[model samples]
Target: MRIPRIYSAGDLAENTSAELDAAASNHVGKVLRMKPGQSLILFNGSGVDYTATITCVTKKHVIASIESATEIPSESPLATHIGQVMSRGDRMDYMIQKSTELGATEITPLTSERCEVKLKGDREEKRVKQWQQIAISAAEQCGRSKVPLIHPITSVDDWVDNKPEDSLGLVLHHRTTQQLTGIDKPQRVCLLIGPEGGLSEAEIESAINKQFIATTFGPRVFRTETAPVAALSVLQWLWGDFNR
Candidate 1:
């Protein structure tokens, strides 16, 4: 039988016992109904998975003894950072989950001119925490040893101001004459996607002025949530780790 894998926030070391967090304990004890002496794997997003067996099970807690660890390398050779404008409802959540599964190294939720999802104060913090959790769970399910970092929500203008010079930066805009596959080999890339309503003309112009190249994915228009995943897939097929 295949052992169930769980992602925890605790420190893991070989020949040591680590207390499973309450959430994981509940999952193993109640959800999975894993009894003592059963085997499972644990990962702390440290690029290694700890092989462990259940040592004790009680009403209040569950403990596992680590047997050994298998070192896992990072997924992608060419890193892609997706800078997506926040969309409404579950749109952003779906984007983050699928992007993590597709091997996006980093994700930034940008608040752009067309963003309809307004978050203020505590709500912003709550949403960021939720999105980060989604990313972690997606990594765990998708067999990624390390979870992608979900950056704190920021404005589009601020993000454009701090973009790195060495990375290839491209924005998804229909007006652009260039296709995504036309780009040459680049070690790292940053993808900028607009919100549901799409980026205003002025916003696109401003991004172009700041040296962000625009690229399209053929003639059909894709939704805000779907655009990043399509672009990432094409990018991976053309010049990234997917070719391996």
Candidate 2:
């Protein structure tokens, strides 16, 4: 059987016994019903995976003894940072999950004039934490040792101001004339995908002025959640490990 992969925030070292967090414990003990003595892979997002043996499994928690650690070589050489407009409900969740699987190094939830989701204060913190967990789960499922960093929610204008002017930035606008094919090779790329209502004209102009190229994905228009996946897939094929 394929060994189960679990993520924990605790420090992991060979022969050290670590208690799984409540969420992970519930998964191993209740969901998977894994018993003591079964082997599983544990990752702490430190770019290494630990071979662990279940020492105890109880209703409240699961404890495992780390056997050994191996560095994972799955990270992409071409890093991509996604500045996605805040989407509604589970759409944002889905975006975070798939983006992590596609090897996004960083993800920032961008709020624009067209954003329908209003988040602030404690609620926003909780949401960001939830999204970060989704990213962690995606990393585990996709065999990625390092979980992508989930940045806090910010305004699109602020995001543009922070990014360098010379970097290869792109805004996925349907009316754009440029395609991804002829662009010069960049070590890193930052992409912005608007919400369901799309970016306002002023927002698009602002991004364009800040060195964000207006790029399109052929003729058909993709949904906000689906756009990132399509863009990332093609990017991977062209510049990331998908070539292997």
- TM-score winner: 2
| Number of backbone collisions per candidate | 0, 0
* Candidate 2 ranges with C-alpha deviation above 4 Å: 164-166
TM-score against truth, every candidate = 0.93, 0.95
Residues 1-244, model 2: lDDT tens digits: 9999999888898889999988889889999999999999999889999999999988898999999999999899888999999988799899999999999999999999989999989999999999999998999899999998999999999998888655589899998878988888788889989999899999999999888899998888999999999999989898888998
User: What TM-score would candidate 1 get against the native?
Assistant: 0.93
Candidate 1 lDDT: 0.87
Candidate 2 weakest ten by summed lDDT? 159-168
Q: Which stretches of candidate 1 lie over 4 Å from their true place?
A: none
Please list the Cα RMSD from the true structure of every candidate, rounded to 1 decimal place: 1.6, 1.5
Deviation (Å) of 158 in candidate 2: 0.8
